[model samples]
Target: MKTILLHVSLVLCAVSSLQSRTWTEAQTGRKLEADFVKVQGDAVVVRAANGSTMQLPLARLSEADQTFVKEQAETATKPATTAAKTEEKSSGKEDAKKALIGTWDGYMADSDGSRHGDIRLVITEEKITASNPRGGQEMGAGTYKISGKRIDATGTEGQFRGKKYEGIFDLDSKTLKWCSANDNPNSSRPTQMQTNPQAGQFLMVLEKK
Candidate 1:
Protein backbone atom coordinates (compact mmCIF):
# COMPACT_ATOMS: atom_id res chain seq x y z
CA MET A 1 0.00 0.00 0.00
CA LYS A 2 2.84 2.34 0.79
CA THR A 3 4.48 1.59 -2.56
CA ILE A 4 1.20 2.16 -4.37
CA LEU A 5 0.63 5.47 -2.63
CA LEU A 6 4.18 6.55 -3.40
CA HIS A 7 3.74 5.61 -7.06
CA VAL A 8 0.48 7.54 -7.29
CA SER A 9 2.05 10.56 -5.64
CA LEU A 10 5.01 10.54 -7.99
CA VAL A 11 2.74 10.29 -11.04
CA LEU A 12 0.54 13.10 -9.70
CA CYS A 13 3.59 15.28 -9.25
CA ALA A 14 4.77 14.56 -12.78
CA VAL A 15 1.39 15.21 -14.38
CA SER A 16 0.65 18.22 -12.17
CA SER A 17 3.39 20.16 -13.89
CA LEU A 18 1.46 19.99 -17.17
CA GLN A 19 4.46 21.58 -18.81
CA SER A 20 4.62 21.63 -22.59
CA ARG A 21 7.87 20.67 -24.24
CA THR A 22 9.04 20.22 -27.77
CA TRP A 23 9.47 16.54 -28.52
CA THR A 24 11.59 15.52 -31.48
CA GLU A 25 11.27 12.32 -33.48
CA ALA A 26 14.43 10.28 -33.66
CA GLN A 27 14.61 9.76 -37.43
CA THR A 28 12.25 12.29 -38.99
CA GLY A 29 13.25 15.00 -36.52
CA ARG A 30 9.67 16.17 -36.55
CA LYS A 31 8.75 18.15 -33.46
CA LEU A 32 5.53 18.52 -31.51
CA GLU A 33 4.92 20.69 -28.50
CA ALA A 34 2.75 18.84 -26.01
CA ASP A 35 2.40 18.24 -22.30
CA PHE A 36 3.44 14.86 -20.98
CA VAL A 37 0.47 12.92 -19.60
CA LYS A 38 1.96 9.54 -18.80
CA VAL A 39 3.86 6.63 -20.26
CA GLN A 40 1.85 3.66 -21.45
CA GLY A 41 3.70 0.55 -22.53
CA ASP A 42 6.08 1.41 -25.38
CA ALA A 43 4.32 4.72 -25.99
CA VAL A 44 4.22 8.04 -24.21
CA VAL A 45 0.86 9.79 -23.84
CA VAL A 46 0.88 13.52 -24.39
CA ARG A 47 -1.76 16.20 -24.46
CA ALA A 48 -1.76 18.69 -27.29
CA ALA A 49 -2.49 22.37 -26.75
CA ASN A 50 -6.09 21.72 -27.73
CA GLY A 51 -6.45 19.19 -24.86
CA SER A 52 -6.45 16.16 -27.13
CA THR A 53 -4.32 13.29 -25.90
CA MET A 54 -2.21 11.09 -28.19
CA GLN A 55 0.39 8.40 -27.94
CA LEU A 56 3.81 8.51 -29.54
CA PRO A 57 6.18 5.61 -29.71
CA LEU A 58 8.98 5.77 -27.16
CA ALA A 59 11.48 4.34 -29.63
CA ARG A 60 10.60 7.00 -32.17
CA LEU A 61 11.33 9.78 -29.70
CA SER A 62 14.65 11.54 -29.35
CA GLU A 63 17.00 10.29 -26.61
CA ALA A 64 16.04 13.14 -24.30
CA ASP A 65 12.35 12.31 -24.58
CA GLN A 66 13.08 8.64 -24.05
CA THR A 67 15.11 9.46 -20.94
CA PHE A 68 12.32 11.57 -19.53
CA VAL A 69 9.79 8.77 -19.90
CA LYS A 70 12.17 6.23 -18.44
CA GLU A 71 12.85 8.38 -15.43
CA GLN A 72 9.12 8.79 -14.79
CA ALA A 73 8.43 5.08 -15.05
CA GLU A 74 11.37 4.10 -12.86
CA THR A 75 10.81 6.76 -10.26
CA ALA A 76 8.04 4.70 -8.69
CA THR A 77 8.42 0.97 -8.14
CA LYS A 78 11.50 -0.42 -9.84
CA PRO A 79 11.39 -4.19 -9.71
CA ALA A 80 8.77 -5.82 -11.94
CA THR A 81 7.06 -2.47 -12.30
CA THR A 82 5.19 -3.51 -15.41
CA ALA A 83 3.66 -6.49 -13.64
CA ALA A 84 2.82 -4.34 -10.65
CA LYS A 85 1.04 -1.81 -12.83
CA THR A 86 -0.98 -4.54 -14.53
CA GLU A 87 -2.04 -5.97 -11.20
CA GLU A 88 -3.00 -2.53 -9.99
CA LYS A 89 -5.21 -1.99 -13.04
CA SER A 90 -6.90 -5.35 -12.60
CA SER A 91 -7.66 -4.60 -8.96
CA GLY A 92 -9.03 -1.21 -9.89
CA LYS A 93 -11.35 -2.78 -12.45
CA GLU A 94 -12.87 -5.05 -9.85
CA ASP A 95 -13.37 -2.19 -7.43
CA ALA A 96 -14.97 -0.02 -10.07
CA LYS A 97 -17.30 -2.80 -11.12
CA LYS A 98 -18.61 -3.12 -7.61
CA ALA A 99 -19.10 0.60 -7.27
CA LEU A 100 -21.11 0.72 -10.53
CA ILE A 101 -23.84 -1.73 -9.66
CA GLY A 102 -26.59 0.70 -8.86
CA THR A 103 -29.30 2.92 -10.30
CA TRP A 104 -28.28 6.42 -11.36
CA ASP A 105 -30.04 9.65 -12.31
CA GLY A 106 -28.32 11.81 -14.85
CA TYR A 107 -28.40 13.99 -17.94
CA MET A 108 -26.41 13.83 -21.14
CA ALA A 109 -25.05 17.07 -22.50
CA ASP A 110 -23.90 18.17 -25.93
CA SER A 111 -20.53 19.73 -26.70
CA ASP A 112 -21.91 23.23 -26.52
CA GLY A 113 -23.41 22.55 -23.07
CA SER A 114 -26.90 22.08 -24.45
CA ARG A 115 -29.19 19.57 -22.83
CA HIS A 116 -29.18 16.48 -24.99
CA GLY A 117 -31.36 14.25 -22.82
CA ASP A 118 -32.31 13.27 -19.31
CA ILE A 119 -31.30 9.72 -18.44
CA ARG A 120 -31.93 7.17 -15.76
CA LEU A 121 -29.59 4.20 -15.79
CA VAL A 122 -29.77 0.92 -13.98
CA ILE A 123 -26.55 -1.05 -13.94
CA THR A 124 -26.19 -4.60 -12.69
CA GLU A 125 -23.40 -7.10 -12.74
CA GLU A 126 -24.66 -8.54 -16.01
CA LYS A 127 -26.47 -5.70 -17.79
CA ILE A 128 -27.32 -2.01 -18.05
CA THR A 129 -30.60 -0.31 -18.78
CA ALA A 130 -31.00 3.30 -19.88
CA SER A 131 -34.23 5.24 -19.93
CA ASN A 132 -35.66 8.69 -20.33
CA PRO A 133 -36.85 9.55 -16.87
CA ARG A 134 -39.16 12.38 -17.87
CA GLY A 135 -41.06 10.38 -20.49
CA GLY A 136 -40.79 6.92 -18.93
CA GLN A 137 -39.37 5.72 -22.24
CA GLU A 138 -36.77 3.04 -22.41
CA MET A 139 -33.82 4.19 -24.45
CA GLY A 140 -31.40 1.31 -24.31
CA ALA A 141 -30.58 -1.99 -22.71
CA GLY A 142 -27.15 -3.60 -22.91
CA THR A 143 -24.47 -5.76 -21.48
CA TYR A 144 -21.47 -3.81 -20.28
CA LYS A 145 -17.87 -4.57 -19.48
CA ILE A 146 -15.51 -2.62 -17.30
CA SER A 147 -11.75 -2.73 -17.54
CA GLY A 148 -9.89 -0.38 -15.30
CA LYS A 149 -11.55 2.99 -15.96
CA ARG A 150 -12.67 1.98 -19.45
CA ILE A 151 -16.20 0.81 -20.18
CA ASP A 152 -17.78 -0.83 -23.21
CA ALA A 153 -21.54 -1.10 -23.43
CA THR A 154 -22.96 -3.28 -26.20
CA GLY A 155 -26.64 -2.97 -26.81
CA THR A 156 -28.54 -6.26 -26.92
CA GLU A 157 -32.04 -4.82 -26.93
CA GLY A 158 -34.15 -1.63 -27.20
CA GLN A 159 -33.30 1.39 -29.39
CA PHE A 160 -29.58 0.89 -28.94
CA ARG A 161 -29.53 -2.71 -30.13
CA GLY A 162 -26.50 -3.77 -32.18
CA LYS A 163 -24.56 -0.69 -31.13
CA LYS A 164 -21.48 -0.52 -28.96
CA TYR A 165 -20.77 2.56 -26.90
CA GLU A 166 -17.17 2.95 -25.81
CA GLY A 167 -16.22 5.31 -23.04
CA ILE A 168 -14.05 6.11 -20.05
CA PHE A 169 -15.68 6.57 -16.66
CA ASP A 170 -14.88 8.48 -13.48
CA LEU A 171 -16.78 7.21 -10.47
CA ASP A 172 -16.95 7.96 -6.80
CA SER A 173 -19.43 6.87 -4.17
CA LYS A 174 -22.09 9.26 -5.41
CA THR A 175 -21.06 10.67 -8.76
CA LEU A 176 -20.27 9.14 -12.13
CA LYS A 177 -18.89 10.90 -15.14
CA TRP A 178 -18.95 9.26 -18.56
CA CYS A 179 -17.46 10.46 -21.84
CA SER A 180 -18.63 8.37 -24.76
CA ALA A 181 -19.15 8.16 -28.48
CA ASN A 182 -22.34 9.99 -29.28
CA ASP A 183 -24.84 9.06 -32.02
CA ASN A 184 -22.10 7.41 -34.07
CA PRO A 185 -21.62 3.83 -32.99
CA ASN A 186 -18.41 3.55 -34.99
CA SER A 187 -16.81 6.55 -33.35
CA SER A 188 -13.73 6.02 -31.24
CA ARG A 189 -13.82 6.05 -27.46
CA PRO A 190 -13.44 9.42 -25.77
CA THR A 191 -10.39 10.14 -23.60
CA GLN A 192 -11.91 13.04 -21.69
CA MET A 193 -15.17 13.76 -19.90
CA GLN A 194 -15.81 16.97 -21.82
CA THR A 195 -18.44 16.84 -24.54
CA ASN A 196 -17.75 17.51 -28.22
CA PRO A 197 -20.93 16.62 -30.03
CA GLN A 198 -19.45 17.80 -33.35
CA ALA A 199 -16.80 15.14 -32.89
CA GLY A 200 -19.44 12.52 -31.98
CA GLN A 201 -18.64 12.75 -28.29
CA PHE A 202 -20.94 13.44 -25.37
CA LEU A 203 -20.65 13.71 -21.63
CA MET A 204 -22.94 12.14 -19.07
CA VAL A 205 -22.96 13.20 -15.46
CA LEU A 206 -24.84 10.98 -13.01
CA GLU A 207 -25.52 10.66 -9.34
CA LYS A 208 -26.26 7.36 -7.65
CA LYS A 209 -29.86 7.01 -6.63
Candidate 2:
Protein backbone atom coordinates (compact mmCIF):
# COMPACT_ATOMS: atom_id res chain seq x y z
CA MET A 1 0.00 0.00 0.00
CA LYS A 2 2.77 2.41 0.94
CA THR A 3 4.59 1.53 -2.25
CA ILE A 4 1.60 2.53 -4.39
CA LEU A 5 1.29 5.82 -2.52
CA LEU A 6 4.96 6.53 -3.06
CA HIS A 7 4.48 6.15 -6.80
CA VAL A 8 1.42 8.44 -6.78
CA SER A 9 3.27 11.14 -4.88
CA LEU A 10 6.14 10.99 -7.34
CA VAL A 11 3.72 11.46 -10.23
CA LEU A 12 2.10 14.46 -8.55
CA CYS A 13 5.48 15.98 -7.72
CA ALA A 14 6.62 15.51 -11.32
CA VAL A 15 3.93 17.85 -12.64
CA SER A 16 4.40 20.44 -9.86
CA SER A 17 8.17 20.84 -9.85
CA LEU A 18 10.52 20.36 -12.78
CA GLN A 19 13.49 21.92 -11.01
CA SER A 20 16.16 19.66 -9.50
CA ARG A 21 15.64 18.86 -5.79
CA THR A 22 17.74 16.87 -3.37
CA TRP A 23 16.46 13.60 -1.88
CA THR A 24 18.26 11.16 0.35
CA GLU A 25 17.51 7.44 0.01
CA ALA A 26 18.51 6.20 3.48
CA GLN A 27 17.99 2.51 2.66
CA THR A 28 20.61 2.61 -0.10
CA GLY A 29 22.76 5.42 1.37
CA ARG A 30 22.34 7.27 -1.93
CA LYS A 31 21.69 10.98 -2.47
CA LEU A 32 20.00 12.34 -5.58
CA GLU A 33 19.18 15.90 -6.63
CA ALA A 34 17.06 15.57 -9.73
CA ASP A 35 13.88 16.69 -11.51
CA PHE A 36 10.79 14.63 -10.57
CA VAL A 37 9.34 13.68 -13.95
CA LYS A 38 6.82 10.91 -13.09
CA VAL A 39 6.41 7.53 -11.50
CA GLN A 40 5.62 4.32 -13.40
CA GLY A 41 4.71 1.12 -11.55
CA ASP A 42 7.34 0.38 -8.91
CA ALA A 43 9.86 2.98 -10.11
CA VAL A 44 10.04 6.73 -9.77
CA VAL A 45 10.90 8.59 -12.95
CA VAL A 46 13.32 11.47 -12.63
CA ARG A 47 15.72 13.52 -14.73
CA ALA A 48 19.25 13.85 -13.38
CA ALA A 49 20.72 17.37 -13.19
CA ASN A 50 22.63 16.33 -16.32
CA GLY A 51 19.26 15.96 -18.16
CA SER A 52 19.20 12.14 -18.32
CA THR A 53 16.06 10.32 -17.11
CA MET A 54 16.42 7.81 -14.26
CA GLN A 55 14.12 5.24 -12.66
CA LEU A 56 14.47 4.62 -8.93
CA PRO A 57 12.80 1.96 -6.82
CA LEU A 58 10.58 3.27 -4.01
CA ALA A 59 11.95 0.61 -1.63
CA ARG A 60 15.24 2.50 -1.64
CA LEU A 61 13.64 5.72 -0.34
CA SER A 62 14.31 7.17 3.11
CA GLU A 63 12.01 6.24 6.01
CA ALA A 64 10.64 9.78 6.18
CA ASP A 65 9.80 9.75 2.45
CA GLN A 66 8.06 6.40 2.85
CA THR A 67 6.08 7.76 5.80
CA PHE A 68 4.90 10.64 3.67
CA VAL A 69 3.74 8.19 1.01
CA LYS A 70 1.82 6.17 3.59
CA GLU A 71 0.00 9.26 4.83
CA GLN A 72 -1.01 10.27 1.32
CA ALA A 73 -2.45 6.82 0.64
CA GLU A 74 -4.57 6.80 3.80
CA THR A 75 -5.92 10.24 2.97
CA ALA A 76 -6.86 9.21 -0.56
CA THR A 77 -8.73 6.08 0.59
CA LYS A 78 -10.69 7.65 3.47
CA PRO A 79 -13.62 8.76 1.31
CA ALA A 80 -13.97 5.36 -0.30
CA THR A 81 -13.89 3.67 3.11
CA THR A 82 -16.62 5.94 4.42
CA ALA A 83 -18.83 5.31 1.37
CA ALA A 84 -18.44 1.57 1.76
CA LYS A 85 -19.58 1.75 5.36
CA THR A 86 -22.57 3.84 4.37
CA GLU A 87 -23.61 1.31 1.75
CA GLU A 88 -23.28 -1.53 4.22
CA LYS A 89 -25.51 0.15 6.77
CA SER A 90 -28.22 0.78 4.21
CA SER A 91 -28.08 -2.70 2.67
CA GLY A 92 -27.80 -4.87 5.76
CA LYS A 93 -29.64 -8.21 6.10
CA GLU A 94 -32.63 -6.73 7.92
CA ASP A 95 -33.00 -4.12 5.20
CA ALA A 96 -32.79 -6.72 2.45
CA LYS A 97 -35.44 -8.80 4.19
CA LYS A 98 -37.87 -5.92 4.27
CA ALA A 99 -37.71 -5.64 0.49
CA LEU A 100 -37.76 -9.37 -0.24
CA ILE A 101 -40.18 -11.17 2.14
CA GLY A 102 -43.14 -11.15 -0.16
CA THR A 103 -44.62 -12.69 -3.33
CA TRP A 104 -43.67 -11.75 -6.90
CA ASP A 105 -44.62 -12.60 -10.52
CA GLY A 106 -42.59 -12.81 -13.72
CA TYR A 107 -41.79 -14.81 -16.83
CA MET A 108 -38.98 -17.22 -17.66
CA ALA A 109 -37.42 -16.92 -21.08
CA ASP A 110 -34.84 -18.99 -22.92
CA SER A 111 -31.57 -17.76 -24.44
CA ASP A 112 -33.37 -17.63 -27.77
CA GLY A 113 -35.81 -15.15 -26.21
CA SER A 114 -38.52 -17.79 -26.26
CA ARG A 115 -41.04 -17.60 -23.47
CA HIS A 116 -40.79 -20.61 -21.22
CA GLY A 117 -43.74 -19.97 -18.94
CA ASP A 118 -45.50 -17.64 -16.55
CA ILE A 119 -44.06 -18.06 -13.08
CA ARG A 120 -45.30 -17.19 -9.63
CA LEU A 121 -42.88 -16.66 -6.77
CA VAL A 122 -43.67 -16.89 -3.08
CA ILE A 123 -41.03 -15.73 -0.59
CA THR A 124 -41.54 -16.41 3.09
CA GLU A 125 -39.54 -15.94 6.27
CA GLU A 126 -37.15 -18.79 5.41
CA LYS A 127 -38.26 -20.37 2.14
CA ILE A 128 -39.20 -19.55 -1.46
CA THR A 129 -41.61 -21.33 -3.81
CA ALA A 130 -41.91 -21.14 -7.58
CA SER A 131 -45.05 -22.26 -9.35
CA ASN A 132 -44.91 -22.94 -13.08
CA PRO A 133 -48.31 -22.81 -14.76
CA ARG A 134 -47.02 -24.60 -17.86
CA GLY A 135 -44.57 -27.40 -16.94
CA GLY A 136 -46.44 -28.74 -13.88
CA GLN A 137 -42.95 -29.64 -12.72
CA GLU A 138 -42.04 -28.69 -9.16
CA MET A 139 -38.58 -27.17 -9.73
CA GLY A 140 -38.71 -24.03 -7.60
CA ALA A 141 -39.07 -25.05 -3.99
CA GLY A 142 -36.10 -24.12 -1.84
CA THR A 143 -34.91 -22.79 1.51
CA TYR A 144 -33.29 -19.37 1.38
CA LYS A 145 -30.93 -17.12 3.28
CA ILE A 146 -30.44 -13.39 2.83
CA SER A 147 -27.32 -11.34 3.36
CA GLY A 148 -26.73 -7.76 2.35
CA LYS A 149 -28.26 -7.58 -1.16
CA ARG A 150 -27.92 -11.26 -1.99
CA ILE A 151 -30.33 -14.17 -1.74
CA ASP A 152 -29.06 -17.73 -1.67
CA ALA A 153 -31.38 -20.75 -1.94
CA THR A 154 -30.85 -24.50 -1.90
CA GLY A 155 -33.30 -27.03 -3.29
CA THR A 156 -35.47 -29.22 -1.08
CA GLU A 157 -36.43 -31.91 -3.68
CA GLY A 158 -37.08 -32.88 -7.29
CA GLN A 159 -34.80 -31.67 -10.16
CA PHE A 160 -33.87 -28.62 -8.11
CA ARG A 161 -32.79 -30.77 -5.17
CA GLY A 162 -29.23 -30.10 -4.00
CA LYS A 163 -28.96 -27.23 -6.50
CA LYS A 164 -28.09 -23.77 -5.22
CA TYR A 165 -29.10 -20.36 -6.50
CA GLU A 166 -27.48 -16.98 -6.00
CA GLY A 167 -29.06 -13.72 -7.01
CA ILE A 168 -28.90 -9.97 -6.46
CA PHE A 169 -31.57 -7.54 -5.36
CA ASP A 170 -31.88 -4.38 -7.40
CA LEU A 171 -30.80 -1.05 -5.97
CA ASP A 172 -34.41 -0.24 -5.11
CA SER A 173 -34.67 -3.82 -3.91
CA LYS A 174 -37.74 -4.26 -6.10
CA THR A 175 -36.38 -6.67 -8.71
CA LEU A 176 -34.66 -10.01 -8.12
CA LYS A 177 -32.41 -11.38 -10.86
CA TRP A 178 -29.93 -14.20 -11.33
CA CYS A 179 -28.44 -16.47 -13.94
CA SER A 180 -30.48 -19.54 -14.92
CA ALA A 181 -27.28 -21.50 -15.55
CA ASN A 182 -26.08 -21.10 -11.95
CA ASP A 183 -28.45 -23.73 -10.55
CA ASN A 184 -25.84 -26.45 -10.96
CA PRO A 185 -24.09 -28.41 -8.24
CA ASN A 186 -20.89 -26.57 -7.15
CA SER A 187 -21.04 -24.49 -10.32
CA SER A 188 -19.58 -21.02 -10.11
CA ARG A 189 -22.02 -18.30 -9.08
CA PRO A 190 -23.10 -16.78 -12.34
CA THR A 191 -22.54 -13.15 -13.21
CA GLN A 192 -25.27 -13.10 -15.85
CA MET A 193 -27.59 -15.56 -17.57
CA GLN A 194 -26.06 -17.91 -20.12
CA THR A 195 -26.05 -16.40 -23.61
CA ASN A 196 -24.55 -19.05 -25.89
CA PRO A 197 -26.97 -21.29 -27.77
CA GLN A 198 -26.15 -24.25 -25.56
CA ALA A 199 -25.89 -22.13 -22.41
CA GLY A 200 -29.09 -20.19 -23.33
CA GLN A 201 -29.94 -16.80 -21.73
CA PHE A 202 -28.20 -14.29 -19.52
CA LEU A 203 -30.49 -14.03 -16.48
CA MET A 204 -33.99 -14.24 -14.97
CA VAL A 205 -35.79 -11.34 -13.36
CA LEU A 206 -38.85 -11.48 -11.11
CA GLU A 207 -40.60 -8.34 -9.95
CA LYS A 208 -42.71 -7.76 -6.85
CA LYS A 209 -46.37 -8.61 -7.22
Candidate 3:
Protein backbone atom coordinates (compact mmCIF):
# COMPACT_ATOMS: atom_id res chain seq x y z
CA MET A 1 0.00 0.00 0.00
CA LYS A 2 2.88 2.40 0.81
CA THR A 3 4.63 1.60 -2.50
CA ILE A 4 1.49 2.24 -4.54
CA LEU A 5 0.87 5.60 -2.85
CA LEU A 6 4.45 6.71 -3.55
CA HIS A 7 4.15 5.76 -7.27
CA VAL A 8 0.88 7.63 -7.60
CA SER A 9 2.37 10.76 -6.04
CA LEU A 10 5.35 10.56 -8.42
CA VAL A 11 3.06 10.36 -11.45
CA LEU A 12 1.03 13.36 -10.33
CA CYS A 13 4.21 15.39 -9.84
CA ALA A 14 5.49 14.49 -13.29
CA VAL A 15 2.19 15.41 -14.90
CA SER A 16 2.11 18.76 -13.12
CA SER A 17 5.65 19.57 -14.29
CA LEU A 18 4.76 18.75 -17.92
CA GLN A 19 1.63 20.87 -17.80
CA SER A 20 3.47 23.82 -16.31
CA ARG A 21 6.15 23.68 -19.00
CA THR A 22 3.57 23.54 -21.74
CA TRP A 23 1.66 26.51 -20.35
CA THR A 24 4.83 28.58 -20.09
CA GLU A 25 5.86 27.82 -23.68
CA ALA A 26 2.42 28.62 -25.00
CA GLN A 27 2.33 31.98 -23.23
CA THR A 28 5.74 32.94 -24.54
CA GLY A 29 5.13 31.71 -28.12
CA ARG A 30 1.73 33.34 -28.57
CA LYS A 31 1.53 36.43 -30.77
CA LEU A 32 -0.24 39.33 -29.10
CA GLU A 33 -1.49 41.29 -32.11
CA ALA A 34 0.14 41.11 -35.52
CA ASP A 35 -0.44 43.10 -38.68
CA PHE A 36 0.73 41.75 -42.04
CA VAL A 37 2.47 44.72 -43.62
CA LYS A 38 4.35 43.43 -46.68
CA VAL A 39 6.43 40.62 -48.10
CA GLN A 40 9.95 40.91 -49.44
CA GLY A 41 10.51 37.77 -51.46
CA ASP A 42 10.65 34.86 -48.98
CA ALA A 43 10.27 37.04 -45.88
CA VAL A 44 7.04 38.40 -44.46
CA VAL A 45 6.88 41.90 -42.92
CA VAL A 46 4.65 42.04 -39.87
CA ARG A 47 3.94 45.11 -37.76
CA ALA A 48 2.76 44.79 -34.22
CA ALA A 49 0.71 47.42 -32.37
CA ASN A 50 3.80 48.25 -30.32
CA GLY A 51 5.17 49.84 -33.54
CA SER A 52 7.81 47.18 -34.02
CA THR A 53 8.19 45.71 -37.50
CA MET A 54 9.58 42.22 -37.99
CA GLN A 55 10.44 40.27 -41.12
CA LEU A 56 9.82 36.66 -40.21
CA PRO A 57 9.71 33.40 -42.12
CA LEU A 58 6.34 32.71 -43.74
CA ALA A 59 6.09 29.38 -41.89
CA ARG A 60 6.11 31.00 -38.43
CA LEU A 61 2.60 32.42 -38.65
CA SER A 62 -0.70 30.66 -37.96
CA GLU A 63 -2.46 28.81 -40.78
CA ALA A 64 -4.93 31.61 -41.63
CA ASP A 65 -2.33 34.34 -41.27
CA GLN A 66 0.08 32.27 -43.31
CA THR A 67 -2.41 32.08 -46.16
CA PHE A 68 -2.97 35.84 -46.03
CA VAL A 69 0.76 36.50 -45.97
CA LYS A 70 1.38 34.12 -48.85
CA GLU A 71 -1.26 35.74 -51.03
CA GLN A 72 0.00 39.23 -50.27
CA ALA A 73 3.62 38.19 -50.75
CA GLU A 74 2.93 36.51 -54.06
CA THR A 75 1.06 39.52 -55.36
CA ALA A 76 3.87 41.85 -54.29
CA THR A 77 6.70 39.71 -55.59
CA LYS A 78 5.24 38.84 -58.97
CA PRO A 79 3.45 41.65 -60.71
CA ALA A 80 1.12 40.39 -63.47
CA THR A 81 2.10 36.80 -62.68
CA THR A 82 -1.52 35.77 -62.28
CA ALA A 83 -2.74 37.94 -65.16
CA ALA A 84 -0.11 36.55 -67.51
CA LYS A 85 -0.83 32.94 -66.65
CA THR A 86 -4.60 33.37 -66.81
CA GLU A 87 -4.46 35.42 -70.01
CA GLU A 88 -2.48 32.70 -71.78
CA LYS A 89 -5.08 30.04 -70.98
CA SER A 90 -8.18 32.20 -71.41
CA SER A 91 -9.27 34.00 -74.57
CA GLY A 92 -10.84 37.02 -72.81
CA LYS A 93 -8.90 39.95 -71.38
CA GLU A 94 -8.52 39.74 -67.60
CA ASP A 95 -9.29 43.44 -67.14
CA ALA A 96 -12.86 43.00 -68.38
CA LYS A 97 -13.19 40.42 -65.60
CA LYS A 98 -14.61 41.80 -62.34
CA ALA A 99 -13.71 40.13 -59.05
CA LEU A 100 -14.23 43.07 -56.68
CA ILE A 101 -17.97 43.24 -57.48
CA GLY A 102 -19.34 44.65 -54.25
CA THR A 103 -19.61 47.75 -52.08
CA TRP A 104 -16.75 48.45 -49.64
CA ASP A 105 -15.92 51.34 -47.35
CA GLY A 106 -12.54 51.92 -45.79
CA TYR A 107 -10.06 54.39 -44.29
CA MET A 108 -7.06 55.42 -46.40
CA ALA A 109 -3.67 56.37 -45.05
CA ASP A 110 -0.13 56.72 -46.27
CA SER A 111 2.99 55.30 -44.67
CA ASP A 112 2.97 58.39 -42.52
CA GLY A 113 -0.12 58.76 -40.33
CA SER A 114 -0.62 62.45 -41.31
CA ARG A 115 -2.76 62.29 -44.43
CA HIS A 116 -5.97 60.25 -44.29
CA GLY A 117 -9.02 59.72 -46.51
CA ASP A 118 -12.17 57.62 -46.77
CA ILE A 119 -12.78 55.30 -49.73
CA ARG A 120 -15.71 53.44 -51.25
CA LEU A 121 -15.48 50.73 -53.91
CA VAL A 122 -18.47 49.93 -56.09
CA ILE A 123 -17.74 47.01 -58.35
CA THR A 124 -19.93 45.38 -61.01
CA GLU A 125 -19.51 42.39 -63.27
CA GLU A 126 -17.89 44.52 -65.99
CA LYS A 127 -16.30 47.37 -64.06
CA ILE A 128 -14.85 48.29 -60.66
CA THR A 129 -15.39 51.86 -59.49
CA ALA A 130 -13.99 53.64 -56.44
CA SER A 131 -14.61 57.04 -54.95
CA ASN A 132 -13.58 59.21 -52.00
CA PRO A 133 -17.06 59.87 -50.71
CA ARG A 134 -15.75 62.00 -47.86
CA GLY A 135 -13.49 64.29 -49.93
CA GLY A 136 -15.88 64.38 -52.89
CA GLN A 137 -13.21 63.03 -55.23
CA GLU A 138 -13.74 60.29 -57.78
CA MET A 139 -11.16 57.46 -58.04
CA GLY A 140 -12.44 56.68 -61.57
CA ALA A 141 -12.95 53.44 -63.52
CA GLY A 142 -10.94 50.24 -63.21
CA THR A 143 -10.67 46.53 -63.88
CA TYR A 144 -10.18 43.91 -61.19
CA LYS A 145 -9.43 40.21 -60.65
CA ILE A 146 -9.39 37.88 -57.64
CA SER A 147 -6.40 35.58 -57.27
CA GLY A 148 -6.17 33.31 -54.24
CA LYS A 149 -8.64 35.48 -52.25
CA ARG A 150 -6.88 38.77 -53.05
CA ILE A 151 -8.36 41.34 -55.44
CA ASP A 152 -5.98 43.05 -57.86
CA ALA A 153 -7.24 46.16 -59.67
CA THR A 154 -5.83 48.47 -62.33
CA GLY A 155 -7.54 51.80 -62.85
CA THR A 156 -8.00 52.95 -66.44
CA GLU A 157 -9.36 56.46 -65.81
CA GLY A 158 -6.58 57.56 -63.44
CA GLN A 159 -7.30 58.40 -59.79
CA PHE A 160 -4.83 61.22 -59.06
CA ARG A 161 -4.96 63.31 -62.20
CA GLY A 162 -3.84 60.99 -65.05
CA LYS A 163 -1.65 58.67 -63.01
CA LYS A 164 -2.46 54.98 -63.44
CA TYR A 165 -3.25 53.21 -60.18
CA GLU A 166 -3.18 49.56 -59.12
CA GLY A 167 -4.49 48.09 -55.89
CA ILE A 168 -4.59 44.77 -54.05
CA PHE A 169 -7.87 44.26 -52.23
CA ASP A 170 -8.00 41.59 -49.50
CA LEU A 171 -11.44 40.01 -49.75
CA ASP A 172 -11.23 37.70 -46.73
CA SER A 173 -11.05 40.92 -44.74
CA LYS A 174 -11.45 44.66 -45.30
CA THR A 175 -8.01 45.91 -46.31
CA LEU A 176 -7.61 48.13 -49.38
CA LYS A 177 -4.15 49.05 -50.55
CA TRP A 178 -3.06 50.75 -53.78
CA CYS A 179 -0.03 52.33 -55.40
CA SER A 180 -0.11 54.91 -58.19
CA ALA A 181 2.48 55.61 -60.87
CA ASN A 182 4.77 58.56 -60.26
CA ASP A 183 5.50 59.76 -63.78
CA ASN A 184 2.32 59.11 -65.72
CA PRO A 185 1.12 61.86 -68.05
CA ASN A 186 -2.41 61.48 -66.63
CA SER A 187 -1.28 61.60 -63.01
CA SER A 188 -0.49 64.76 -61.12
CA ARG A 189 3.16 65.72 -61.07
CA PRO A 190 5.05 65.28 -57.81
CA THR A 191 5.52 69.02 -57.37
CA GLN A 192 1.76 69.58 -57.45
CA MET A 193 0.72 66.62 -55.36
CA GLN A 194 -0.31 66.95 -51.71
CA THR A 195 1.35 63.80 -50.33
CA ASN A 196 5.03 63.02 -50.58
CA PRO A 197 6.18 61.33 -53.78
CA GLN A 198 7.61 58.41 -51.82
CA ALA A 199 4.32 57.96 -49.96
CA GLY A 200 2.24 57.09 -53.01
CA GLN A 201 1.30 53.72 -51.58
CA PHE A 202 -2.11 53.98 -49.94
CA LEU A 203 -3.22 51.57 -47.19
CA MET A 204 -6.85 51.67 -46.17
CA VAL A 205 -9.20 49.74 -43.88
CA LEU A 206 -12.68 49.21 -45.33
CA GLU A 207 -15.91 49.28 -43.33
CA LYS A 208 -19.05 47.58 -44.61
CA LYS A 209 -22.07 49.83 -45.16
| Candidate-wise lDDT, in order | 0.80, 0.63, 0.48
Off by over 4 Å in 1: 1-89, 183-186
For residue 176, what is the lDDT in candidate 3? 38
Q: Which has the greatest lDDT?
A: 1
Global CA lDDT computed for model 2: 0.63
lDDT (10s digit) by residue, model 3, range 32-137: 4555555444444556667686665544445555455434434443545777777775543343233344677865555564447677867687666778877767
lDDT of 2 by residue, 11-121 (tens): 343333454556678756778888766555666677987789988776777766556545544555577689999888766766666667787776765676566567767
Full candidate order by TM-score, most accurate first: 1, 2, 3
**Backbone clashes (count) for model 2:** 5
Which ten contiguous residues of candidate 3 have the minimum total lDDT?
15-24
Error of 1 at 56 (Å): 53
Poorest 10 consecutive residues of model 2 by lDDT? 193-202
Better of 2 and 3 by TM-score: 2
The clash numbers for all candidates, in the given order, read 0, 5, 7
State every prediction's TM-score relative to the real structure.
0.56, 0.46, 0.37
List per-candidate RMSD values in Å. Answer: 18.4, 12.8, 22.1
